[model samples]
Target: MPDLVPPMLPATGELADATDPARWAVEFGWEGHRCVAYVRRGRVRLLSSTARSVTGSFPELAVLAEQAPPGGLVLDGTVVALDEAGRPSRGPLLRRTATLTPDAALRAEVPIGYVVTDLLWCDGRRVLELPYRRRRAELEKLALAGPAILVPPSFGLDEAELVVRTAEQYGLDGLHLKRLDVPYQPGRRTRNWLRVPLRRRRQVLLAGWVPAPGRPDRIAAVLLALPGPEGPRYVGRVGIGAADADARTILAAPSGPPPSAVPDGVAEHARWLAPGLAAAVEHRGRTAAGRLALPSWRGLVPDDERDDDLLDMPAAGGSQGGGPVSPDPVRDTGTRARDEARSRPRADAGAEARSRADAEPRSRAGADVHSRADAGARSRTGTDARSGAGPAGTDAAPVPAAGPEQPGTWHGPLSRRLEQHFVYNTLNTIASLVRTDPPRARELLLGFADLSRAADRAEEPTIRLDEELAAVRAYLQIEGTRFGARLSAEIDDPAAAGVDPGAAVPPLSVLAAVRRGVQEEIEPVPGGGAVHVRLVTDPGGPSCRIEIRPADAVRDPFVLFSVPLDVPEGL
Candidate 1:
């Protein structure tokens, strides 16, 4: 498999009202290392935001390679370590990542989990053209779960505020809101996704340091500054929340003369340093004098990681609810749009411009021309069955089904054909691994056999209740190996209710419904939950109903479909 590229990132922005839930989805903003993982065949590759390979740093993430669906899969998420309260803690995660080759003892103490938020590729195909909702559906199909990997729940507009509040209450960083219609753009930062933080944090340059009283060798505090209209200006001092070793390191760095004009009271004891080191400072809010209030050191920003915009000072006298004000919204939007447009692939620029120019003239003549061109394109390629033809052309022929058309048949030209090919290739790949890893190979081979048998009999007109349950259980067990404890199911069998094992029902119907219920209703929950399947028979009627529900309520809107079972005539 080819190497997977690093994921596109979102630009930093303030949160705004999301009045339309259908176009937006929100999730918790995890405070940890941003990592993008690629699972190819049975090997895992993890990359940091800077495209640095960190695969050796987190051995726990190897579970992703085993649990990921066959073929190649690429995921974007954060590597977080949870505190006792189950909330993400950045300190522990940092310590773990800092060690390139952690010992077993350190690994046990600071175990990390990957909180997956987006799916970029699956089954050897790049899914960047699909909308976010579709990508999320494909992600859930993988049933990603385990001690090392997790898929967090997402919420709609109505519950977005609640999610943010809940995150704040749980001591989380904040929330991330993404537009559903936007496609993934590699290496580009667009407004399609916005991040909102619960507290104020900024990266400031380390200007100078104050020597400890009566101990010239030791450091008292570090002076931080933000870029001013003329030069770097004193913002505040970081005196707390750092260990003695950290303080010593900052003070020991090469020093030079103080700034041309030092702020009053700071110059008396401050020793200036060369302007290269930077620190991430967290604080309550800015004081009336525009100085940071109660600032504490978070960590040092790597020398290569500086962004000039991040250091730009906010306009003076601009305050929001007594908190540090954000940059001008109007200016920020214009700058962001320009940057995005400039970053777009140059090859697409000409075509995009031509299309935009052609779309401007909406006259009847233009419409007719566009209709003819679209019809010609469809005639050359085959009309899509999923999206019916427009008024300009007649509907094209439907793609042929692999077998007899069934209720659960999928007719997508690309997907249906790829399904069997992908599965066969996966089995062959696993079989080859048997020489080296017999145990895992054995498990995968058994799962492959069971799944193949179930698929072969799926089109049968009818099957026994016990047979259907067996197939469903086998399938769940296979998927469970991938998800670990994240995916779970409890079935109350019909035999427990005294129903005959020989009772006939539509083949694969119950299994289809249960799988759909879990994917749509259960798996999307942020931290994952359980799914319960119950068999309920009507006392007065001839019909039997299967109930499938998740342990947690779904926040996104969904449509439910009912499938009728085929009963033998005159039974």
Candidate 2:
């Protein structure tokens, strides 16, 4: 079932968004092993993004045969050398993605390579000659291969400057834009995409934080991002001081980019790089002092940040809101739903929890960090699904059924699983907003219903009402999610709906009679009232009987525990 969790395919944001034909196979595949993934003799094979099969290097991709879609196909992709973070940039990858066996420079980094650019046969379709736009559309639909097939993270904004501004403010990379009509040109690079990055977003030689000159009571600024060995060139100071509580928290931290190979010239001033004092700065821009521009210290004095909640603005290309939270919409969604959010008395704990989810969860080897299965399974990045509902609160694209059993190797099932999970989670997430704020939950419900209907109607796996509850709980818990089932239900006879309806029952009939068993457990809180029972015998085969208990609050008890302990898995 874990395998059914989609592979972690890279999002559209990761690429160069090339539209022209000159950059092909040059920038990303500049050197190192270039391999493509394909199916031959019922086995998955690796090929160079340039169409050359280099299957031996990555034998794991070949083992993907059983999970591949039912088709013989080929693809153009890169064997991206990953970094400590799992995913790698061409520039960084060039220095890292290598096999240590013989070439140290080639196998420069650990955790080796991930296959990120698949442009070929996926789901039995030949997308090679298709325009970059169409092929990418299908490619995006491919299942996650761990960190493989990393669709580069992309950002669409009103303008490039605004993107750069926001990235700096958030201390992140700027933007990458691609044309909607470009064609796929393997081994070719075009200007179909644009990247306008913030100066502070790039890697910098950490120096130190400048104290409030003589005040010593305040950290006036963080001395980070230098071009040479001069370390701690003292980038401009951040006047945005924190409250006493925040000050204490900030003062008790470590610095220096969290211990790493200090690169080349950084050691010259490494002595100045003080340990402890991590500053969560929003990279504003580059300062004339060879430092990050007016950076704002974000996590220093956390009050209540709206962006960290499930209720906060969401969906793909979230502009007026924050950009793609991560690669998947689920993780970001879950992060937002974190109950401890907002109301937290201190920002440190909240930041820690959120950061933990954001940074950790290392992608396993042979895993495509960008594969949809892996990425979708772990957490929702809050990015809108290209086919499903837009982040604008709408219905979803029709999707196929999914299950934990299906292989996350192919494009279709993996996507279907993600789509199903997305719908199921969205429907189940409950909070004060869903109950007290029915309007918003209702708005979200409309979209969920649309997605469910679409998935139900498609070849996608059928969703059990119980599974919906579980997904919703898992994904929406942090946000605000509620629970319900037994819509359009009916009892054969109201009188018989009472206790002890006469009938020769099946062994599993006990599952439907949950009120008569397990959930009959919890006692009411201090002064709360006792629970109740409700039975709705559907006009169909599977009739239902439910008990309302303090603990078993769900309309269907199966969601909590598999009664009779015989239900199929993934329900």
Candidate 3:
């Protein structure tokens, strides 16, 4: 096994408008901690994005090391804590990760699952140079069956939209699209992958805070504003979704003078500051007044971000005002409450005037005049009652009609369903193998264990090409045992080819190619068939390539069947 390195990071990008289904594969972008696992000879090490050791945080993942293959392997994945319904709960995961010493009770309460996405090394071979499809194939050959670790299922481009829609429905974050032919590039941003989020995120200015009543040092809500034509316009105030630490940080920042004028309908008591801090906010949409509706603070943004960046934001619409236009005091109960407190004296005077007018009544007029007055009073009262207004003499405003309901997004149960299906099928296959050849079944079982162990390694980035080939051969042997003589395979690498069996290749690259051929081409035939795999070195290049030729020269079976294309020709 080779020395481990930092995990490759995915670049953030928008999904392309149109993409070829054949060229891309999609996986759910989980809402949890990004983790890189190194498994060496049965020891597992979990590292966070910052390369900090998080091994103690998730003890369940240690099983990876015990189940690893003979050689070491490195895995890039996510650590997610699932809720009661089995949906990834980011809050729980965050809490779990923050604990320095996890107790048994905490572990039981928040059981973590590692969702392996990419394979960087296996056995002793470095796989970063292999195409993504090939790496996926290699990963599959590991046959990851997890109580704690499992490979996430991938979808085709045609299923991309459905996958994302399902993710949202299931409370997952979004979908990640990775190009099939691109190789892994560690710590570098590339177009090989794109992330499409379920929610839109914006960076806005954090201009001030409304202090918590008694805890003058604490913030009840932080005032968020965005750059406007004139200057910074108040978007809204965010109290929810921000943690206590965030409040403390905001308070610690140096305070400056308030804005020239407070936005209309905003709390006059809001303590303002210099307009330099920025915050990342998530919301459903903007109110009619261009204020954020149900705005949640994601976190503070870089201090260097400029207000001009927000000028192009779509004019959000709702009653919540973003600027001087006051939100309807009648409809906006929150604003009305705050304003009513400040103008209580004026409200009382207005009530007294109304009472005096009512007291003067019909008796002061003649019969005809009194009748007209009675009719006018009845009309006013009736209209007020219908409009949801309070006592005529008070300053109460009319209630607004309910807004249209937004349709619920679909939460696809695809992830769990597919996982169940895979497990069931694998168990059934194992059962058949046991009935046919118990000794061979034992070997395959050990192979399965080895694959699992390899995936669990905490160290060792690259495995020996020979060891990787061995694992693939073990898998092929298992399949051969199941199908008997009907299935055959040939490894054509010879000393004359000048290819080093000891040369490093991505784990499972060879095996994945062979397995893909068997599954798509050979197994589908009326009778099983043979597959030929040849390993060759580039004459003047530093790369090794594997050439796979199935018995039948059919159109690439993967392309025909629309399965994830996993060939190693371009390696």
Top model number, TM-score: 3
Instruction: Specify the highest-lDDT model's number.
Output: 1
Each model's lDDT comes to 0.55, 0.33, 0.54
Error of 3 at 477 (Å): 33
Q: How does model 3 score by TM-score?
A: 0.40
TM for every model, in the order presented, reads 0.39, 0.33, 0.40
Stronger candidate by lDDT (1 vs 2): 1
lDDT of 2 by residue, 1-571 (tens): 0101111122234333443433222111112355555565467655443444455545445445654666654655445442221122244444432332324333322323443444556665656557655665565455443422233322222223333332332223334454545554444444554434433422222244446646765765545432222222344344445444444444444433423323344343333333322233545343223345556544321122322211211211211122111111112111222233334221221223223222222211112113324333221112322123222333423111112233111124223223322322332332123325655644554434322222211221222233222222222222223223211112233245532222211211222122112212222222212222232332222222222233334322221111111122222
Question: In model 3, which range of ten residues has the least summed lDDT?
Answer: 402-411
**Model 1, 378: alpha-carbon shift in Å?**
77
Could you arrange the candidates by lDDT from highest to lowest? 1, 3, 2
Clashes of each: 3, 104, 30
Candidate 3 regions with alpha-carbon error over 4 angstroms: 200-571
1-571, model 1: which lDDT tens digit per residue?
Answer: 3475657777666557455788988776887888889887678889988989999998878888777667778898888875432446666677898888989988767667787888888887888778998887777667675446667666566666555444443445568888888888778887788776655455677788888899987778888886643457788788734455456556566665565446778899898876656666666444546577778776665433333233222221211113222222112110221233332221111223223212222222223233336433112112221123311233322322122223224323222323323342333344344445656655554554444434434433344555566656755665565456777777667558655444444445555545544444456655455544444443221222333333455432121212222232333
lDDT of 3 by residue, 1-571 (tens): 5445676666677667327877898777877888888997658888888888889888888888876787778888988876533456666687798886799988866777788889898888888789998998888778665666657666567656545544443445567889888888887766678776655355676678987779887788899876543467777888834465556556665556554346755557787766556667766444446567677766664332322243233222321121222111112111112222332211111223223222222222122222335444122222331234432344433211111111110111222222223322333355344435555545554554343323221122233444555555656666676577778776644345554444433333344334444654466666666665544333222222222233444422111100011111223
Q: After superposition, how far is residue 481 of candidate 3 from its true place, in Å?
A: 25
Whole-model lDDT, candidate 2? 0.33
